[model samples]
Target: MSNDKIKEDLPAILERYRDRIEATIKPYLSLNLTPDENLTWWQSKFAGREKSPGGFPYLPKGFDYPQTSDGEYLLLLAQINFAEVPYLEGFPTRGILQFYIADNDSYGFSNYYCELNYPQSNWRVIYFPEPDLNAENLITDFDFLPEKYWFETTELEITKCSAIRWTKKYAPICLEDDSAYKLLLPQIGEAVPFELEDLYEEFTDAYLKILDNDGWFCPLQMGGYSCYFSDDPRVGFSEEEDPFDTLLLKISLIESGSLFFYIQSSALAKCDFSKVLYAMA
Candidate 1:
């Protein structure tokens, strides 16, 4: 990668590639989560019906808490109550979706690279098509957790129960994905009056800059395109071979990078989470 800063005429570039850019656009939900400072672990155990991340989970009575092969409890990464979300086509109108990952160094992803068939024991996605809305009937005791789900700072223990606020957005396919270059370059070449061979890198860099400037680079999103720090997991597979078609959920963590959950369209429509795929990068 070049260290030298490259700038382009952004307006001209946007006008040139407007059609290609528009074609890649898709709708997504941006998760805005705020933690409640006053919330205690005890309160979280009460299992209120809400969308959150990294707090106590909402479990139905008698529901088995997900665990690893060694019987270690998996931690809640995110819990999405679709009923709280704005409606999106092909997504469940009303349901509770929870993502759990083994509380380990790799966060349940043991592989150095992304792959398929990640053991459910390591990571799991649970969907309750008809979720129990009553908090009283939900599991309320989480004393089994090894430690309080809050971190102890030098000052004091800060307990949190994050509350999610969903904002619907139209996100274009990420230009960073290698496949975007393959798909859009030909379209650009035909549309633009000037040759793009020499200006490819400059154009791509500027496009990213424009996206960032416009505040389209969301770290945590549902649906739309998949974002990555390394390789796109769907790279090797052809369209026919790729079963995981939808980016169900994506949570970006600074410590372990990003967690991506994908599901097949058919599976998502039928509310089958058994075939959901997990990948961390």
Candidate 2:
């Protein structure tokens, strides 16, 4: 069905489970930037430093670019200057954060026993708490990167850059996961009659279908409920056990896949990306 049709039917979905789903609502910053093949790397930086999907990240003088375990340079997946982003809880008010992934076929996702392994060797999340704004001090030469890695996998080229405009919006849970439902059950139960006990699956499916169809779920966002194309990373953990409370970033990949970075609130506050969990779906 078309997005207009789904949007027209959204009211019905909301009215049916208004109380239950309302509690799941959380705000997120929507990144509005379209990748243009014609735009040169210099043109992307014309708007000054900003958030981008794939770009030459802001590298200070002394900092070495992130590399995989094999010592190959990781490609920039996203660069987020928190100064350009709105204030989000548990998120830095100022800093330049970058997500780098391997240029390999797997996009640097390393798995163990068919499950995502922690302390990922192929991907990296670097935080520059105090970004030096001097352009001359940054590394300008990026010709060393392999040319094949620049191709656009989706609409966005992995190597080209596009400046981002932030739009703060509200979102509810998109994917269905038992752990997530259980975690929010208490709050949802308090608002209504615990109707989700019988209608959780049915309601969630219908609601998410509308949201997804209408493009309400962001392919790249910050500090919001994660909308995965496949499985949610924190699906197995219990309510009391917090695997990850912060959705650091989510980047869409080819074939409806996504790369996610999750971190604890405390760790994020400390500007520590060491313990952040990397997941691909």
Best by TM-score: 1
Best by lDDT: 1
lDDT of 2 at 83: 77
- Write down the worst ten-residue block by lDDT for model 2: 41-50
**Tens-place lDDT digits, model 1, residues 1-281:** 01122133446756577667667767777766566634322221212223233367768789988887788877776677777778877899777788777766676766744545545777888878777668787776777766423112222222455666777767556765545765667645424446665567677776776755222346667887755776777655445354676888776655445677888888888888887667765
TM-score of 2: 0.73
- Residue 7, model 2, lDDT: 21
Candidate 1 clash pair list: none
The CA lDDT at 221 in model 2 is 64
Error of 1 at 229 (Å): 1.9
| Runs of candidate 1 exceeding 4 Å displacement | 1-10, 37-54, 113-115, 148-159, 187-196, 213-216, 237-240
Candidate 1: 10-residue stretch with minimal lDDT = 40-49
Q: Each candidate: what lDDT?
A: 0.63, 0.60
TM-scores, one per candidate: 0.76, 0.73
- The residue pairs found clashing in candidate 2 are none
